[model samples]
Target: MKNTMAEDKIVADKTIATKVIEKLREDIINNRFETGSRITIKEISERYGVSPMPVREAFRTLEGEHLLEINPYKGATVLRIDEQFVRDVYGVLRALECLLYETALDEIDQGVIQKLRCINEQIRAIVDLPYGAAEYVDLNTKFHSTIMEHSKNQKALEMYTHYHEIISTIRKKYIPVPERIRTGIEQHEKLIEALEKKDVLLVKMAVDEHIKSALENFMTQFSQGK
Candidate 1:
């Protein structure tokens, strides 16, 4: 009975930690907690009506994402997001996406192609809506995920999903800008064309260029803002 109770408690703490991680991830990304802002386990625990144990677990995860720095003496602090941070995130994103596409080539069928085409149509139509950035991110994520989901590499797919969440948040934040959106749609169309031809070389080129263009557009806008 004691063992079962302990296991249940562990599960409960993990559930609470996941909730806290989600809330805190978005909060930090959206600048609710500005860069260099300090956060303590006790404060977050009280705010979320949870215990310090779960909050501590969440802090470890946020730190892993490079959004926070954990200090043994000073609790946690939000990290500065700069050009280097963007590059590092997108760099891994590019590699993972390229690998996903490579592995998915054997699995690419008419069904996946049609799904991407359908999503592309939605992307085109979304621009007409007054507020569609969030939806756009969803569609974009769906589009990539549909391709990446075919990979036999469970580990890479999981990491891809995690990184893609961060990418979507950044994209959603910049949704008002037409430049990045338009460029993305164009590359996506190119990717579909390459996929249709089953030209491995072109597919590789298309995916590589797609990531490059996204990084370029993000850098341009991010630099101008700074």
Candidate 2:
């Protein structure tokens, strides 16, 4: 009975740790933890009402995701924004998005294009309101994710998701300004036009330009501390 109980406890601990990790991951991705903030195991354990072991395990998992940096005595701090990291990620994303557009041109249907158009329109409607930055960010993610889903390339989808996770972190720190937001909407509309026309070359160019322009704007703001 003692051995059986110990095994059950171990299993429970693992489950609890996984749950904590997932919850914390969401919080981090959602920018709940302020940029450059430290995350202590004790605080996490207290907040989640879990043991230190689970909190530590959760931290380790986040660390692996490049979302946290663990110091020997200082505990964990959210990773700082790296401009080069964003540049490299966006570069890769541009290339992959172009490839996805080409491959998905024939496979993409009117329904998917219409869905994207709706999302874009919704994004436009909210661009001038309070908290519009956050809403735009979410809508932008949904728009790109929807496109990737229709790409029908499992490997490409996986790669895109990985890059997207990192990009989400960067975006939270530097939400685009109103002008950039307007430009992004325009670019998205052009992308939809390209898709509707089934012009693979045009779609690819539009996607690349959209991403490149966004990246440039983000880097400029990041440098200027806007």
Candidate 3:
């Protein structure tokens, strides 16, 4: 009976900790926590109506994800975004996407192509809206994911999904400019057209150029301290 009771207690603690971690992650992704702002265990514990133990456990997990940093004197502060981090993550993401595109080229069907075109049209229509940047990010994710989903290599698909999630988190704080959005849509159109032509080289080039343009634009903003 004591062993069972102890097991239940452990499970309960884990459940609470997991909940705290997820909530905190969502909050951070939504920009509720500013870059370099401090997060306190006591504050989180109070907000979640839980003891500090679970909050601390969640903090450790967030730290591992590079979303939080724990200082002995200062407790926890949200990590500042860095150029290297953006470059590295985006670099890996681009490579994974290109690989998936190549592997899945033959597998992409007309229905999926139409779906991507539909998504692009939605993106173009929203360009004038104030909140279109976020919507574009989401639709763009779906557009790429639709193609990446056709990859027969499960491991590549998984890696692309993982990198894309991190990219999504990064994007939450960014709102692309109208020019960038317009250029991005054009690139997407080019990619779709290339795919329709069944030109392998053109498809690969379009994908590479699209990623390059995005990376350059992001780097330019990061350098300007935007």
On TM-score, the candidate that comes out on top is 1
Any residue pairs clashing in model 2, and if so which? none
List per-candidate RMSD values in Å. 6.8, 7.9, 7.9
What overall lDDT goes with each candidate model?
A: 0.78, 0.79, 0.79
Better of 1 and 3 by TM-score: 1
* TM-score of each predicted structure versus truth: 0.84, 0.68, 0.70
Worst 10 residues of 1 by lDDT: 1-10
Please count the clashing residue pairs in each candidate, in the order shown: 0, 0, 0
Candidate 2 per-residue C-alpha lDDT over 65-177 given as tens digits, one digit per residue, 9 for 90 to 100: 67799987787998754677568878988888888777777867889988999999999999999989989988988987777776767898778776766676556667668
Model 1 clash pairs? none
Clashing pairs in 3: none
**Residue 80 error, candidate 1, Å:** 0.8
lDDT of 2 at 109: 88
Q: How well does candidate 3 score on lDDT at residue 103?
A: 80
Kindly report the root-mean-square deviation of model 2 from the true structure over all alpha carbons. Answer: 7.9
How many pairs of residues collide in model 3? 0
Q: How far is candidate 1 from the true structure (C-alpha RMSD, Å)?
A: 6.8
| TM-score (C-alpha) between model 3 and the true structure | 0.70
